[model samples]
Target chain A: MSIPNDRKYLSTHEWHKAEGNVVTIGITQFAADELTDVTYVQLPRVGATLQAGGSFGEIESVKTASDLNCGVSGTVVAVNEALTNDPGLVNRDPFGQGWMIKVQVSDLNELNALLAPADYLKNAGH
Target chain B: MLKHTPFYDFHVSADARMVDYSGWEMPLMYRSVVDEHQQTRNSGSIFDVSHMGRLHFSGSDTRRFLNLVLTRPVDDMVVGQSRYALVCNESGGVLDDIIVSRDNKHYLMVCNAGNREKLIQYFTAFRREHDLDFDLADQTESTGMVALQGPKVIERLASVLPVDVKSIKRYHFETAKIMLIKLSVFRSGYTGEDGIEIILPAMMAGMAMKMLAGKMDKENATLKPAGLAARDTLRLEAGMPLYGHELDENIDPISAGLKWAVNLDSNFVGVQKLREIAAQGPKRVLVGLELEDRRIARQGTTLATSDGAPVGQVTSGTFSPTLQKSIAMAFVDADHSAIGTQLSADLKGSPSQARIVKLPFYKRSNP
Candidate 1:
């Protein structure tokens, strides 16, 4: 339920932090808690272009799976390889060690479309 | 609204993730599925399985009636003995897998909750048509079932139970009293672990669980509260067949790798068809599948040849918390169900390589 004040969240449960034109992407703690015991993470390949609100990959728990969506239009620059072997990191540290991908922003205008931390917390019923 | 068990409030207070299961509001997990699963495998854990149906059969002709309906021969079963068997339809298709326990004066049958109504209807119809002189009573609503499982489970149970838990042999039950409430404690469980399932009055369920849980907390013991999610994973690791997942009305026990439960010489509802299937062999058979990768192949996933030709479908699959690998049970073509046959599973449209292996992905060290 603790959403980092500096991050922006999507209604689909993903969060992003824009540092200049580069953004770090990860699912919020709310999402992590909802999808308990993540076993596998299908991440988007590096250098793949993704549109805002589009699904880039999927995350699987023991009993269910959910698609991971992009909060803003960007090009995937780097994916967290640590998650490939230890998907439970998402459950342990959804904000810190569990970042899924880093992207180079393709449209800064889309950033304004995301919800703030407070708004996201309210929207997620946290 | 779904039906709730006696321990529903206990589960909610423990922060269980509730899910709808066969019209029952059941806890999927208390902490996490993987954690609970590991805890159960390494230490001790308890599960609330009261949603399953419990039936009592009594009358002068109880033995004859059950012997004719159940696949296993229960005629010679002594008191306190339990046998795993399947209730088959007239065409050899399975109605439900059940455990029949013989008490001193009557018989008790435990079956899947989803198949309770069907089973009761079948029993009623059979009795009416055949003029069987036995009384069938549905004991599920008033009974509460809890299973304490794992290697160290006996220690935790012995702490609270008055009886010497070790005296009851496997697949046997003994009548005892917990807090003055009569209980039928069975030395059996689904996880293939050494444990006991206590069946008691529904109103006493909360107190009984609190006693067990309190004992664990007081002694700093290894006993933890697990849920259906962990139960599913544990049973999958143990290679046990679930009712809706592995066995269904269209699937016969012979094809589901449950031939041991079926007695060819015994006269049951589907004995003749079962005999024919046994002689000719089933066209498809259930086999254990070991995925080469960590990708979990879930139920309904299409299994096929390595070259992409479809062969069968996965019935039950999960990531085994013990093995740290994904495993599945699939009903593949009988000829292709060999121990070393290579196959592929269409996991979300991508084919994952897998191989058929001998059942039971994990076995207890002492077992």
Candidate 2:
């Protein structure tokens, strides 16, 4: 499992890649590996607002169901519709095409509090 | 510490995701759950199911003891026949569902691992009460079990075994030797497929798997290592009732749609209560639920009417890999258990459209 250095991670396991004021958000590869064979994903509406450290969605795997939390507060700019048709993408490419949502950043300062790759790996017990 | 099966090392070497199940550290998957599920349906797959309890009974009083203990009639069973039966409480509640196979010299009973100790205690008490002279042996720890399941299972088994795999009838078991290792092969499985479950000495399990791998490699047949996820989905598709999910102390065979296994004519432990249940139907009945869309209705989800009055509870639910739809088994009020009756599943507070479908959302083409 590759943990991209460019992306910041939350202790809850969600990852955020900042690009200017927009942030590409998804669950970390570590999270996907733990869940295994994701069968369903219920994402928030594209226009809905999110709260930092709040549950933004729900994911269901073969044997488990869990909440997906948001790392930072923002407006949901886009939601991955592909997951509805093929949820296995979350298992296959958690960091790439499996990206869950895109948030228009309301506070760029929030990224400073997120964990770096090294910190995340240690905290996640990788 | 969790118990480890003989295949524990093999699973770890293969990087399988392991989880604690019924006090056993068993592999949840080697590759991905969906991959294994599809492979088992289309090809062949091996499963390490050594956690299941195996008991051997022998002596002059074996048949009488079994007939009195189990809900099935065992008096007419031939040497090579096996019957699916339920061990019920005096009140007709299911203790465990078991498979009793009659060998030439003794009888073999396979019970669920989670209920092993409880069933053993129950049987021991019964034996003392009846003063029977039968010897009961626990073969679970001494033996290892692996199931080769799917459409292509017989061909894969034939590649390694000397006997004709197609000749053994379903529910029948035969002792065979492959590469000088004795295996008690049963032509049965929980999956809705033609498969065989092999039981051997624990020490020889790894060797047997290696031999199976070699045969499959030679034949170029489809065989993969499957896990508990696939096993569960496969059994659900087959409409087979799992013990904890569909059968329990609170649920009886009649309510769980296992009436065929309960022979009321025989005076068993639960005969009186079963007779009472037969005279007056159970208040709640098990029914199959098919979600109209892809949204999964998980277990413990409430089943409600279209207008939103709660009617029942979902026992087991999953995204049916075979049907490519969401399906579940729920215990609903008898009044709402009719086929095609419109219903809805309360999924995280949202009422998802569902309907009562026939039991077994998917059935094997051949079966």
Candidate 3:
């Protein structure tokens, strides 16, 4: 459940690990912890252009359904195919294996404005 | 902030995933909902239902008090038998749906968890207004409940309980001292299964659970601890309606498809309003609907006709585990509530294909 210092986090509980032009997006461990057991996931389509803060997908937990928002502006490169079969990976390891999507960043400058791990933990009220 | 129950500690120790459910911090599930739900369907499942309310009535004519307070008959109740009833306001609007069991000296009223406080206060004022010679006690806080539910539950629990589990008829209950504390064992539950709900004294609840758990382990029984998450799905598959969602302070029992529980024979506060509604028929009736796709219609989502005209609203909805498709219950116009009627459920932003199904989406294989 530890968030790496290298990644930038969104206030909406998503983490963005940027490596040059490609960025990996996933809901935070805190988000997955709050969601409990994930049942079904409606993932975003690959090769689709999604602006920052847009809904990339939706996830249903045992109790309720929640929206997965885009952490940074990008065009969808790839999505976690395993999530379609076993959505519970979101609960197992949200930071690594449960990454929702791979996006080609539309705005490289936008990543600089995102919250750091310390600020993310503060904003999340943890 | 979520309100914690008296059994919050017990839930946490059992590794329950806690969640804020309508202001109550309750166990979502101890394990998985699917497993727990199947355990209930296949074997037995225990539930921590300590948050539910128990209102006691002890007076010479407590039977008459029930006749006055509920829409069900008090005179017809057999000893040790439980009957479902609707506690109504003056306008035939349902205040709450409850189960009342007639004990020799008192009547035990089990109300919904969310409506416990409001119902107790309502009865207090009603008892005062009519001079109903009965005492009302909200024993929800001090009482912890554990339900052994499913087909094999009675047989499994029989090893620990002294009573002949097979002899206890459905909906009948009795009081006994299980281990050390006084206990009330009711052969009743929400799930469509042969089971019993064990009510133990608040202090000795842990003892009761430990004994049950020990028995389960010794027998190598397929028993799992269920929670509110599995409880909801089980109730839904069994065609049970949850209060606040399906029935509110405004909905009448007649419209909720609970006429069998309503006793129109004797007069109650809402008898006239009920009679008027019965005579004219209700505008909307609750019905179970099955969707073709896996997309669920959430609560408060609007129901529409094929032409997109709004008809009613979804009261409860979810992807049914057993059915393997989306299933929901909605209050539709009485004309449309008929079985096999086609209706469009507005799934999020669009209408989804659905049809009115039978009351119980899952038909049990009765012995």
Task: Extract clashing residue pairs from model 1.
Answer: none
Q: Which parts of model 1 are misplaced by more than 4 Å?
A: B215-220
C-alpha lDDT (0 to 100) for residue B314 of candidate 1: 96
Lowest lDDT block of 10, candidate 2 chain B: B212-221
Clashes of 2: 0
For model 3, residues B1-367, the per-residue Cα lDDT tens digits are 7766656787888888887775678888876777788888988888888777888889766788788878988787877888889989889888889999888877889988778878878877877887777777777768888888888888887887877777888889977776567888888898877788988778877777877755443334667678988899999998998998888889999999998888787788899989988889999999998987656788888888888888888999877777776789999988777788888887678577889988888866863
Number of the predicted model whose DockQ against the real structure is largest: 1
True contacts kept of each: 0.69, 0.56, 0.12
lDDT of 2 at B219: 33
Q: Tens digit of lDDT per residue, candidate 3, span A13-76?
A: 8899888899998988888877766767787789888888789888877567888887677788
Sort by TM-score, top down from the best: 1, 2, 3
Residue A57 Cα positional deviation in candidate 2, in Å, after optimal superposition: 1.4
The sequence of per-residue lDDT tens digits that candidate 1 reaches over residues B180-218 is 889888999999788999999999999988786665433
Candidate 3 chain B: minimum summed lDDT over ten consecutive residues — where?
Answer: B213-222
What tens digits encode model 2's per-residue C-alpha lDDT throughout B1-367? 9999988898887788888989999998877777788888888889999999999999999889998889997988888788999989889999999999999899999999999999889888888999988989999999999999989889876878877788999998888887768898889999888899988999998898888755433234488788898889888888888888988988889988888898989988898998899879988899998888777777789988878789999888888888888889999999999999989898888778889889877777885
Model 3 misplaced regions, further than 4 Å: A3-8, A17-22, A80-86, A92-99, A106-126, B1-6, B19-25, B215-221
lDDT of 1 at B302: 94
True lDDT of residue B184, candidate 3: 84
What are the DockQ scores of the candidates, in order? Answer: 0.78, 0.64, 0.29
Candidate 2 lDDT for residue A126:
73
- lDDT of model 1, residue B138: 98
